[model samples]
Target: MHNPRSDKPVLVGVESLDNVQQLVRTAGDLADLGAGTVRVVTVAVKRSDSPFRVFSDETIVREFADSSHELLDRATTPEGVTIERDVLVARSAARGLLAAVEETDPAALVVGWRPQEQRTDAVFGTTVDALVERAPCDLYVERVGHEANGVDSILLPVAGGPHVETAARAAIAIAARNDARVLVFSVETSGDAAALAAEGREALAGVDGPEVPVETTVRESDDVTGAIVDEAAAHDVVVMGATRKGSLRRKLVGSVPRRVVDQTDRTVILARSGDVVGGPLHELGRLLRRW
Candidate 1:
């Protein structure tokens, strides 16, 4: 049920068999983040008609080899990491991952975010959207760095409020794991922006802001959308909040996350809310939805 080698910070990779290739690649990439042990806990959905056997035959990943058990074995074998495979014959991707995480209880849950325009983007739809709002542990909503094999500084566009805390906390762990830095930025339109940003930083005081030095910035601007997009373009990864339609004025009006993801080449890690604080990703999402 757990890796006995070392606590060495865990990164839980979640996905259906459709993402086996990506999962294997991500597991290898994360291994380089630290000498610490890495485990790739993956789930293959086993429906009545589409049993686990179907996935076994189609897996292309040499490291993972498509077999859930084999993937976990190989990961822990050559290294200290452990892989736990599951055949969750479930109705949804999120549900399958939720089951795996509950069973595994990894340190930090990592999930890839493929662009929506691609042909295989069905995997990035409401399923992931809901999961982003609800997964266990701090969810790493990744996109670009997976292809590059590593991430640079995490460009977290902060609003200088408690709302950005969840995203900042998640970014801290991810940055530490990836040997990355955190660029905490807040775009100012007017009205004592520095003072306002100080207030926001105060909210983050109690959050788990790992050793990775977080560089906070308060930039003056008139346009919120353009400033955010501009801020997103500078970093290798963009971390922000996905405000609800009823409460998130910026997101509801301009769909800030959708826009940032669209206009920037960097990967977007959209944390839905910080209200739930440091818990599983799903708990935060579920808590926010009630608000």
Candidate 2:
């Protein structure tokens, strides 16, 4: 629990009870990786002034104290891993989280999203949708039901974008930490596996830690969603871009993200423009704030 910031402590913001468990589970995976330690930060942003509110800045600080103590008491939290966690109160939770990213300077931020109960919210959760638009650090938006600890295998589909490399960097860092190999696939009519592998190797070239094995695959079909859905089942997580193309069309033609969320048991990560170092990932950024 030393706190000058180890290799890269994860900054996680959770809003739901479900997210709390998800964050805890993911934190364990991050700790196991030795990429650094995983710290949990649960945040609540309020729209109305209600005393029922527990996320006030001071209140959060106090609650974080209790939560951390309770968290430590449990056998689930690894004994040796460092835990520097907090509860934050902010006018806008997402903005506060991004600010924390700047202030705490974690390598990246992990966010949990359980698709909205209704059809529209399924498109995106309001708060999660906002963080994608504004978060400063790399973001990994995870869906529920991810009970696994290590991301032994991953699928990062290079759906063309300015922030594509951002996703690659995030994936590389993750793979390096977990001692996992990444299968980089881009849904395309034609793409060179050798070339894609080279790109993945290049993207991960300078990151800290041991080398991460990389594989490249290109799937063909008019259906982007089908390709992603099929491959994701075999992997632990899927990091893919969400295009701004008509939702109905993508859904009908196949939205890789929508289907992945709908069909898989694995965690699905949505990376936006600011996260990736390059611009390809920025392609999905366009969808972040749109209606």
In model 2, state the lDDT of residue 7: 69
TM-score of 1: 0.63
Where model 1 places Cα greater than 4 Å from the true spot, the runs are: 1-13, 16-39, 48-87, 105-107, 118-124, 144-152, 160-163, 177-180, 190-196, 199-210, 244-254, 272-291
User: Please, what are the lDDT tens digits per residue for candidate 1 over residues 1-291?
Assistant: 111122334455555445444444444434333334455554444455664545542352232444655444333322343344444434456666666656655545566666656544233466565455455454555563334346777776655433465565556545766778777667777666667456445434545434676677887778766887787666766777554443323332125666677677765666544233345664666567558
Model 2, 1-291: lDDT tens per residue?
Answer: 111223667777766554565565555544544545766766556556755364546765675567665554441444455666666666677766866775777656777777655677435665666666556655667776564566788788765544455566556655765678888886665655446545544554544435678888876677766777888888877776555455432331125566667777777776554433325454455356343
lDDT against true structure, model 2: 0.61
Q: Looking at candidate 2, what is the lDDT of residue 188?
A: 64
Q: What TM-score, over all chains together, does every model reach?
A: 0.63, 0.72
Worst 10 residues of 2 by lDDT: 247-256
